[model samples]
Target: MKVFKVVCICTIYVLMIMGTRPTVSLFAHELGASINHIGLITSLFSIIPLLFAIPLGKKIDHLNSKITLLLGGYLGVLGIVLPGFFPNFLGLYLSQLIAGSAQTVLILSAQDYIGRISTKKNRNQYVSWFSFGVAVGTLAGPLFSGIIADLFSFQITFLILAGIGFISCIIIHLVPNEYPIKSKKSPIPTSKTKSTFVDLLKIPSLRLALLFSALILFAKDIYLTFFPLLGLQFGYSNSTIGLLLAINGIASVIIRFYLAPITNRFGTFNVFIGSMIISCVAYIALPFFPQIVIACIIAFILGIGLGIGQPLSISLTIDNAINGRVAEALGIRLTVNRLTQVITPAIFGILANLIGLIYIFLVSSTVIALGTGIAGHNKNNRKTDVMEDSRVKSI
Candidate 1:
């Protein structure tokens, strides 16, 4: 498959997701959601994904990516549209849950499709472009949603997001597949799933990378939910808050363009650790700054760190995957990611509600810093040579 097409398809899916995630938090807030409800609603997005991750990965291993994409597209559209049509707290829950499930399938299919399609020599660059699409979608999604929300209402913003999701669905159908599904030769082809849960645990590097991914995403996901709350506290409009989050996405888009070279020079491991340092400092310091411009600037800085960590972690995970289990390994990675995504908000909401919202960042920074430390000393961090990363893997 051509790299651009895979990237295009993947970008469409992520765009719709990024559009809905942050805006939904604001929508919930308007519905009188307390911090606890917001956290619970935020965490709802990962619940279905957490349960179905591995099974969905196995489906990619045995079945076709095209069908997976189609399913994801439909669910994604349905997920985002629910709140627009219903406009209630229950709507928020359904929207998040379905979108999460859709994302689990869409991501697994795209990553596996790319893994099978790319060569070692070009893998880093190709993946960077793919992730850059994610950055772009992320950049565009909330900013667009915020403007739309301010001009209209959060409910209208939800309709626009639903439209984005539906557009992605249409794009998926129209786009030509670079790697069409393998035609069945006999009754069925043999499915080669690799890396059992126990076997995966035996490898220190892969496990560390997975943990790193989960923690990093946890910080980011929670940041999306909390940043808006923080903004509202300071009396910023929903549109302004969106721009604040969008600054992070914009910085990430810029950084992702240069991420491959950065990875090549510093090694993914080192870059990942550095990202954690930046994120920790930025998140911890965010509590002290109530100014919108300053928060936007800090968001940009935090974006640089996070922007680097995401693709590098994915690369590390892909490089370390077992035979024919790249999708499965990715599935496990997401399982961890979604688990952290699910639990962190659950705890974060209550704690933030009990003490203060600032502590969420404080505790998150500390947790991420600890995870980064573990990753820095990981046994499997030796796979620095991106040119030789074409090993058979599952994730």
Candidate 2:
């Protein structure tokens, strides 16, 4: 029941975010903003998270997570509806700022909430279900956004997105508060906060997890921010673009259904590397295929490739975290992801302007390939470290 509730809240949260972000990109384009400008606007969504994810993760360790969730939900609703009223570049930027902060809080609280309630035996399954919620939201959010924006105006679409976020807020309010409020005392010593980050980063497996997460975000951010523009360049309509995005979501949902069993069978490292290779291929294919059917095929392939990696990373981080610091570890993970989210689009935007957008896929694929190499090295180092620790203990 708890896992079910967590899935419900996360699905709704992701639905609002995934739906609104693509619309933001398309809306900015409609308002005469260039691709470069759209990328900056998209990067703005990660600004708050980039700065505060770790601290907020630490904070959630002591507070009532449900309250934090409620705050984020309502704030998200406010952010989503901002552009509906303003409908300009300024409104779009402001919405990203507010909505981004809400995103940081909602995700941190949700992951922490689920982690605290789950045990080692079931953590993978719980995180997988939580991810499943994200997948479902991803599938539905863009489809709804595209259809609504096509049928009505962007402003009306924003209003509807805000309404869905509002519903998520209500469900969050009703989610049973399973986490007990910790004493006001900090879990980690104040002086050790900086060290805590460093300590977590020192773990080879955790480092690999963060890298895997960053690579995933690199693909996701590129696709979400640019695919609409790419589709437009190919003369695809908003509805068609949304349909493609939704198809990607469908692939993610499908893979997540089998994620745990697959991970258990192949091991996380193999699955991680394999899925990334799949994404790299999809990235290479995306710009070359302008046909609707081929594009849909690419989106699904990309979805399956990207979907399995995130939950696997989450479970790895939680599994390896120091006792009572799971949320902070997740915070560290989000910090890396948000940083990727923050930098990639803006840089890709500049690259797009200089080199042309068609080649951005080649650039993204190369980056992913490099990241995969580094993560694989870290995985080997993790094995070495584990063996050495065992040898020392045996001695």
Candidate 1 TM-score versus the reference: 0.90
Candidate 1 lDDT by residue in tens digits, 1-395: 46677677677667778877788788888899899888899999999889889877866866666788788888888888888889998888888888899888888888887777777788777778888888888878888888899899888888877787776777677655544334223222334753355555566678878877887898788788888888888888878888988899999989887886887799766778888899999998898898877888899999998888788778877777765667777898999999998998888899998999988889889998888777665544555543246453422
Q: Which candidate is the best by lDDT?
A: 2
Once fitted onto the true fold, the runs of candidate 2 whose alpha carbons sit more than 4 angstroms away are: 180-195, 384-395
TM-score per prediction, in order, is 0.90, 0.94
- Relative to the true structure, how large is the alpha-carbon lDDT of every model? 0.80, 0.88
- Please provide, for model 2 over 168-268, each residue's C-alpha lDDT reduced to its tens digit, 9 standing for 90 to 100: 88888778885643423433345634445676676667878888899998999999999999999999988999999999999999998888789779988
Q: What is the lDDT of residue 148 in candidate 2?
A: 97
